[model samples]
Target: MKGKGKKLRKREKAMESGSVEDVLRIDVQNLIVSLNQDNDGVAEGENAAPELETENLPEPGTEIDVKVVELSSTGDGLALHEGSKRVYVVPFSIPGDTVKVKIFRHVLDESYSIADFISVVTPSELRDDSRIGCKYFGKCSGCQFQMMDYSEQLKHKKRIVEKAFRHFSQLPPELIPAIQDTIGSPLQYGYRTKLTPHFDGPPSWRKNREPFTSRPPIGFMLKGTHQTLDIEDCPIGTDVVRLGMKNERARMEVEYGNYTRGATILLRESTRRIPKNESRPSSSPKARSKSPSPLPPDNAAVKVETESYTDVKTCVTSNTATSTEYVGPYVFYNPAGSFFQNNNSILPVFTDYVRQHILPPPSSPSSSPSSSQPIKYLVDAYSGSGLFTITLSSLFSGGSVGIDISDASIKYATENAAANDLPLSRVRFIAADAKDLFTPAIRRAYPGDQTAVVIDPPRKGCDQDFLSQLLRFAPRRVVYVSCNVHTQARDIGVLVRGLEGEGSKGTRYSIESIRGFDFFPQTGHVEGVAVLNRVDE
Candidate 1:
């Protein structure tokens, strides 16, 4: 394996020494073979670029025309200069959009540069040229796909997952299960359950404008810059969440002096915040609505909006029936800033999918052959606030235990467990570091022989120790959930292939299924869930 890898690297080096096009082609082909499958311009009559203290960047208004060939994993369109070996990342642009761009950031040694989308010289067919998209589409770093068809976004995301696995994982591509199409978000817009708009230093930029109000600008930050792009409303959030921002601003206006420094405020809406009797306007961009809701209650005020995502004091919420256990709703306390799913509408369906993969229905006599192991115990590692741990605990008779690094998360998880009326005998949560996520007692309770382990780690994926301990304690089945498919694929490789130096077995597990969940519509971010089972002894 080492010799083959060295030979592959040598071949890649040779290719790099050749034409840039050859290097790119080979790199792309390898991604498919491995598992695989696979800007610019500004010119003319365009709005002049914003002036700034020019540094080592291209002239503040310099226009460079280029053709966008593809999109980076982050969803930024990429234009390659084969002759110069230069790559430019143009945000809010899509593949096949030939455009002239105004370069904003350029560091020669970095081998690439950043540019703002100026004008589309020849638009891509995938481009949604409705011209009625988000007003802040490009300037605000919020939604990247306002001009992209949602279907195209899903296609690009599916390819992103493929590239992640092909480029990062250590296992053979043939061993990977079929990659499924990305599950689209039911509510593409107005689905965000949370909203956090912040302010920066005193309105220095706005001071020059005539009749400037003392009120600090409120909205999202400009793309790739710290400057705030104040707005009257945000289209992505629910009507309640967006309209409530005005009330928050009103409250902040009165208490503006209380804010001595820049801070991001929080406003979360429980999808259930609005009663069932009310109608939820369609999330389609075509049906984008700005209907207002009553002002948020006075208590919605945030105190000391500190850096740790302070204050859920006002806009607290509960999960809707569809997103949690059918028998009960899991109520999470959001004061401590624990993470939760953003797209509420699809969460229940998403969790249902997870449940489906984790538990294949009992094989009936007449049913097709499908292998399944009835799991007794469950370990929800990285179980922040115990969402999965508490919700899925009742399924396993031997009981379930959750582990998280944050004490706040564990505390809230404990409260949530009680709130959901989860039996203590069957549910538990532990706050521990990565190494201690699984302890002797937790292990003892679950006699690993018949256990199921579900993990949802951050984008970087699992660490070596977690992978080592996971394999060492060999659960009967594993359900790995990740938002970053690249890292998920990398961790999947480590799990399937085991450690590089410690060759204990040919393969420890086999992929049962893989699927993607589109959590953030109009953006590149995606969530993926994969299931695997241990090879029988």
Candidate 2:
């Protein structure tokens, strides 16, 4: 009995690892084991395990017509071939689409094959090709849903969130709340604040290493390949950045020979606030010259002015140069090359959602009735340059502290705090390892009952040690923001289970809500936010 319990626990842990392939593998193995157990009393010849039918598998380079019946979490279309009893993963094909695809590779062990999309014979009702904003939508790897309706895209994203939690959390369906519809970006196109375009130099194997007779592609990578497609303009980039791309490409025309290796050029959008009275017309060269960084000839500049202030937009080329952006009334300055949310239009909405959900845990009847302390302290882990710390400082009466492993990020957070005129007594920035973030000093300063933590980790999600430390800290509430929902689901599962055997005296957490924000609208990417509250049993 104990051995069976250990095996079940291992199975639960396997579910938490979070991948469609992993889940399928486990399911197949479990089925085989169950079949064997059922036939234990029967002769081996009576019910032998069926051999996998590999003879019917499709060959590479073969063309087949398939009707896409479902959309995978990765934004690809899934079609099952009846003849081969195999699933086909076709890119650039939407659910309900009748597509002609060329078989590229087979995953015979999994009974699925990968195919390259040829053409859509019949478009799905959800697809509106006319609505696709970019001409490079089909070839460019940057976007997956440009042909999909905006409303449909949001719906699909919500499904992605739901599927992530279902596949990875390993929790009962009753325990998880219904996921909310994905929040859409205000400006679908012309919203991305940064664009990186690159061009390759002559290959090393070439004997001559001669300069190219013609200019090479200076844009994003092509779909399924590392080679870049020459893109004169990208609709997703802000107008200023698009113009900057053209200007930089022209500059590279003359200087392309100066490099022996390929290089990526950074085009980050910077916004400056100028008093309306002092602002000049954006088209004027003088207005463009106001930038601290030297301007290229015919530099693009855009200005939007209100009664009190004018905001000018320009592209910053230097990675180390300071770039500025405005979220609401608040201002943020980070290194141009450093990581910042590329989608600016949706940040205000995203931050507001976080603010609204950070406090006042739901009342539980079973726990003895006692008035819960109002959450007065905020802890922003993986805080980058004070985006969340400063934006949320006003809500916490006791104080807010931002912690980051990067010392440079901490320095800028402090500077941003000062820049925003936030009272020093009300806010602080700490440079510390996230795993050791909740030290004795922090625990004493901000008690768990009155503190809320907001962790916005990278795409890889939080480390196990850091998550264990977080469980030990046990804040009243936790708002986890992640670019990758798969990782988020795995980490949340760990927190929900409370690190049972990980040498931590942590309690379980109840999930309050889960949702996705459409940070990158045309793409498969969705930013997931999961709110968890301590379960006071």
Candidate 3:
């Protein structure tokens, strides 16, 4: 326990410093390890330099040619240097592509350097620039893998999950299973249901109170810079949200002088159920002529008709306004400003996989022999608006519970369960801290031996306290869903390496599978899900 505590503390200290380069070093090292796994000499590129004079590292702004050997977890290209001790990270470059780059920053302590992509001297077979969808592909910070082929993108994400465990999960290699192929999204582009485009006020405009001669840039931040790029339309956003962006930009132009400071404008797509026979009110000529509509008349107000009802989608700008999204037959409503999955196209596949793996596979009518006791209950941790609980309640014979620290989220989760027509008696929501998850009453109500827990934590991942409680609970199975694979790996590592050698009688967990879902296509972002089964000694 002392050794494990020290290791976790060291990692937490580094994380608290908030240095992106420190995290990148771990990913870069893992990338090099994966590349050379087969001893195939993947690092021996033609342009790779041998152990360089550490003192003679390339000066900042120096131009050099290098062949990319792999891509880091951050979606930057990695090239071997100084015999893999020192590495060069080039943005917007792919492996097997020889590119010219300008050295920008050197992380001497970590033995890696950051470079700006200049031009490709030779392209990788997997590199297809023609596949790029966005006009601001290289310069925009919003996306990283737009220039890459979609199939290759999925493969790279799989590699990212493998590297994540290798680097952050401090477990024996044999304890981990082979990483699964990444699930691809249905829509490669135009899948995002929300977009928050913002613009900064002109410097000192508040004091000057002057009108600008030109329109300010209203878009996302530029890559590697603090400035914003004037993006008129984003291809990644849904059609309704994109139209909202256009309308919002127009409003910003006229109201730029009124703002005291820069602000983010929310454009969240919301859906409402209308009668199948009803005509779209927002699309009517009379409604368009009205002086004030809930949304701009030009903004998309689309009507999708089905046999039972019609779904009308529109973009919501107010933070307090309700935003609706659907995953299969389940509907979810959250504040427009609140966090929800941005890509609706991938929810069906993602949720289905989660449901299938919630418990041990059914080998027979009951449970597998290895898992003698079948899991009949579920606990969805950090469940916002009952995304997992409502969707997964049908599988558990003993019903499910959704828990969150936020009372507002718990309230919404309860309401969402009722709205989805799920039996309130079977589905419940609780607002409580993770540290006090398994109270005496709760333990009696839902026995851990028959319960499966699903955890979907934020990007920072679970803290040590939460992990410790989870280990003590010793549930039948744990399905960890995370956006930040690094933190997920760290947390899972702690759980897998429980206090066995120490004084306590610790329960052990085995990694069943690791898979990534392509929630955001044409981007480096990946959503990872890891399944763990409690081991019987």
TM-score of each: 0.75, 0.87, 0.87
The C-alpha lDDT values of all candidates are: 0.66, 0.79, 0.79
* Backbone clash count for every predicted candidate, in the order shown: 10, 0, 0
Instruction: Give the per-residue Cα lDDT of candidate 2 at 225.
Output: 72
lDDT of 2 at 315: 93
The regions of model 3 sitting more than 4 angstroms off are 1-23, 30-53, 80-86, 205-214, 275-298, 305-309, 364-371, 500-505
Q: How close is candidate 3 to the true structure, as a TM-score?
A: 0.87
Clashes of 3: 0
Candidate 1 lDDT over 214-333, as tens digits, reads: 667888989888889887788778665776687778876777665545777776653222223335422111222546334335455332233422222234433221121111244554
Q: Which digits, one per residue and each the tens of the lDDT, describe model 2 over residues 81-113?
A: 645445677878798899999899886665567
Error of 3 at 178 (Å): 0.8
Clashing pairs in 1: 32-36, 32-37, 40-99, 40-100, 40-101, 41-100, 41-101, 42-100, 42-101, 323-348
TM-score of 2: 0.87
